[model samples]
Target: MMPSPGAAQPPSRGKARRGRPPAPISPGTGPSHRAWLEPVRSELFTSGLTLDDLVDRSGYSKTRISELLRGNGYYPAWELTFSVTRALGLPTPPLRRLWTAAAREAHKGPDWIRHCIEQVAHETEGPPLAYRAFCETLHQPYLQYARAFLLTDPRARGVVAETFDILWLSWNEAAASPDIRRYAWRLLRSRVMLRAARHQDGSPDLRAAVFSTDEAHAVQDPGHFMALTELIDLFEAITRLPDDQMDVAVLHYLCGFPDHQISHVLGLTPALTRAVDHHARATVETLLNAPNTQE
Candidate 1:
């Protein structure tokens, strides 16, 4: 079970092994978050705010902030994080870069889905009707949104598949629904949240192949890697914005969601939503105007 944030956990004292040394990376520790957040959390501790203190300030649950620190959950929206920084009386500094690094580390989809899709296709080819129906109806758009929504979740594809599997079993019900997209999205979201509720041992999953160190390196030679590095830096800057602004930026700029739909989905007032979008754009512009960042 996950321990409560900032509460003193009972010590699990045990007899030490006389000869065996601890592994370089223990597999038993549960989910932890970004590499940079530890220092940030320490700074906050120095400021004398317990995890409980952060709840009211960030308007997010203590568990969510704890998740961010522990790196077991999804990458956080920037607004809430920025609120914590301000509450702790810290300047924004280079946190955006840190945020981008967190995003990169949190990313697990592109590879996992690649493997899963191929495997599924091979198995489902003979019964293309049911499989193809599910895919053609919901896969592309819904999968794209799920990938975006659960930015830090490693189980997005599985959740999406499960949602569709339900739809497959209830095709008549799905067809009868007045709004299939909404129904499917709601189902997928519930599944994602359910997974989020479960405790994850902070132990590292060693199986993932990292792209930043491998493919990113392949994008440029040692002498030219600076360009790739800078691009990464830009992403960090974008992540510095709070989630509302970030969501607006992503939905508007990337996903091409219009004002009304974005407002509808996010439940933001129209004027406020526009303001958030403007603020998001300005932040990006300011970041671009500044000096380039390095590792």
Candidate 2:
């Protein structure tokens, strides 16, 4: 019979867990590994599920799960892996591929990648779908926003594919829960902001380039084209306003998210969202009427 979920397994007293010790990566490893693993680990740790929960649902032995995480054991045969994955409510194929890649790479050079794989393998002891889906849902809408953001700043293109990979993995893994999935969208937005801030000083021209008339016409509807132009102009004007006002304007006008959703996304009370919107509208009006500002 399987152990009950949440039951703690007694640790083998004074014995080192079997399997090879985790390999240490060299000092010169690139940023890619750290960048990749950090997000993955963050998602798992924040997922709210535990290792025993996964074992209960997946029917895999705790020892096997431990070995997989340690990077000391081969991936379970396909059927078993699939069953556990489904039980955890994760998207299957991408995770299987992730597991395969991690297992294969664990034995190769570049200790960073190996270490990351081992860490992910270990840390991701919970059921895959629940946490992964949670992370994916948090990021998908922002994926759409990222695509649009890229239209203005092509430099963002490099990270786009990697971002999608993370989203995909999260989606497949966490899709079973609505709350977790929705939170994924919020996380995606946060990531975009981080990326923008990182590149902000380096690319002043990006804003002007993205908002240009030629770029506006690419939307293909004469009405939309005109609206986009106006919107872009308004957004530029918004930048001159105080930061809080600018944030409110962007959330309401640019993203079109409902006031309540925006409130939740920004961690503000609904009353604050309304107040911010009102202040932003007043600020925009003041800016629009000021002499020498274009309509």
lDDT of 1 by residue, 1-295 (tens): 2123332221122324221221222232222232345445545544455666666555567777676555444555555555555454443434433444344456645554344223311211122275456566556544544554454435557556655554443344445677554455555555544444221442112112122223445665665657655544544554556656765665565456688876655556789888998898888778777775211
lDDT of 2 by residue, 66-184 (tens): 44333334433434444444444444445544444433434444454444334322323443464445334434334335544444435344344444455565553335455543445
Return the top candidate by lDDT. Answer: 1
TM-score of each: 0.31, 0.41
Q: Among all windows of ten consecutive residues in candidate 2, which has the lowest summed lDDT?
A: 197-206
Score each candidate by Cα lDDT: 0.49, 0.48
Regions of candidate 1 where Cα sits further than 4 Å from its true position: 1-142, 149-155, 159-231, 292-295
- Model 1, CA-based lDDT: 0.49
